[model samples]
Target: MVMCKDVVENIIGYIDAELDDKTLEELEKHLDECPECQVFVRTYRKMLELTGKLRERTFVTPEIRERLKQLLKSKLKPN
Candidate 1:
């Protein structure tokens, strides 16, 4: 079984489906008995949900992409 601390750190990757099978299994086993990890997982999932909603709301406009590109280019330019 993985330690609670490691599971907490990997919670985001797990929720994002970025974890390998072994890591996922460890996290799952830990979450099974650990309420704190379960809550962390729930909160992480809710954050992802909110982020998706925010992205849908903000990125539907072409202006945001253009503005982001402009900002990046400005930041990347030599002073």
Candidate 2:
């Protein structure tokens, strides 16, 4: 079963459409039932779009991506 954390961990790949077929299918199914995740995904997409229009483009390496995932997971965690 795909959990919220799974969504967060895989979000980068999900947005890039780089996930394997099975993972993508599972993530989409979870997204369909989870309003919070849907909102998160939309907001993330908008952030990416805004950033993309900037003069300097940030190249995200695997290390940076891992850090981003940790940052996002921290933000999403309940107090």
Candidate 3:
């Protein structure tokens, strides 16, 4: 059975349609049963979509910058 961490690790490939048939099958099975992973994958895809559409000269408010910084820090923190 695929774990949540496995889902997280492979999500980018899954979204890009780069995963192989066997791995993609496993991921689909996991996603079907895992609501948390489903949410995570959805959010990751949305982030990819937003970033791909981002303007080169976009403005970031100070508060938004700070929040993004915190989010990055938390994600990078060791569990």
Candidate 4:
């Protein structure tokens, strides 16, 4: 079983499906025994779901994208 601290630290990676099988299994086991971690996981998952829904909408206009691109290019250029 994994410790609560480790589980909390890696919870974001787990939610993103970025963990290997061994790590994911360990996290699952920790969640099984820790109610607080379980609640944390549920809340995190809900937040991700909400964010994903919001991301489906187009909030950035094309003019904003061009300005952002120009800003990034200026920032990336060597002095």
Candidate 5:
């Protein structure tokens, strides 16, 4: 059984398909029994899909770029 904390720590790698076979199986088992994690995984997958769709387009609008910059700046600001 996987702890929720470990699942939280590794969820991104699991979504990226970087986990090994055994670890993947363990995570999958956890996901099956964990409704909260299941919701998180589904939302995360949707975010990835939307980002990928944006990437497939040849251009990003200036507004999008500015918003992304602001988001990055907010993240990078010192606490």
Candidate 6:
């Protein structure tokens, strides 16, 4: 069974549609029943949309993109 923690951990992949079939199915099942998780997903997507709008108005150079990628990679690494 997919748990709340699993939802959080796989959120990015889920939003990006990168999860495997089984995991994706499990996550969807959980989301269907979990109101809190449904809110979280909506909020997360809204945040992404707001940030994306801001990004659209700003100039993000290749250097900035690479730096952001490196920063995200570092932050996403398991301790």
* Strongest candidate by TM-score: 6
Tens-place lDDT digits, model 1, residues 21-53? 988888788889999888877887888788888
Score every model by TM-score.
0.58, 0.66, 0.65, 0.58, 0.58, 0.69
Cα error, candidate 4, residue 25 (Å)? 1.5
Instruction: Arrange candidates by TM-score, descending.
Output: 6, 2, 3, 1, 5, 4
Which sections of candidate 2 miss by over 4 Å?
A: 56-79
Q: Tens digits of per-residue lDDT for model 6 on 1-79?
A: 7888899999999999999999999999999999999999999999999988885575888999999999999999999
| C-alpha lDDT (0 to 100) for residue 18 of candidate 1 | 100
Higher-ranked by TM-score: 3 or 5: 3
Against the true structure, candidate 6 has what lDDT?
0.93
Alpha-carbon local distance difference test for all models: 0.83, 0.94, 0.89, 0.88, 0.86, 0.93
Give lDDT: candidate 2, residue 22: 96
Off by over 4 Å in 6: 57-79
**Judged by lDDT against the true structure, how good is candidate 3?**
0.89
**Sliding window of 10 residues with minimal summed lDDT for model 1:** 52-61
Candidate 3 stretches greater than 4 Å from native = 56-79
Summing lDDT over every window of 10 consecutive residues in candidate 4, give the lowest-scoring window. Answer: 7-16
Candidate 3 all-Cα RMSD: 14.1
Error of 6 at 13 (Å): 0.5
Candidate 4 vs 6: which has more lDDT: 6
Residue 9 displacement in candidate 3 (angstroms):
0.8
Predicted structure 1, TM vs. truth: 0.58
Model 2 vs. true fold: TM: 0.66
Ranking the candidates on lDDT from highest down gives: 2, 6, 3, 4, 5, 1
Error of 4 at 48 (Å): 1.8
lDDT of 3 by residue, 1-79 (tens): 7999998888778878999999999989989999999899889888887898866656998999999999999999999
RMSD vs true structure, all candidates? 8.0, 18.1, 14.1, 7.5, 11.6, 13.6
The clash count of every prediction, one per candidate, is 0, 0, 0, 0, 0, 0
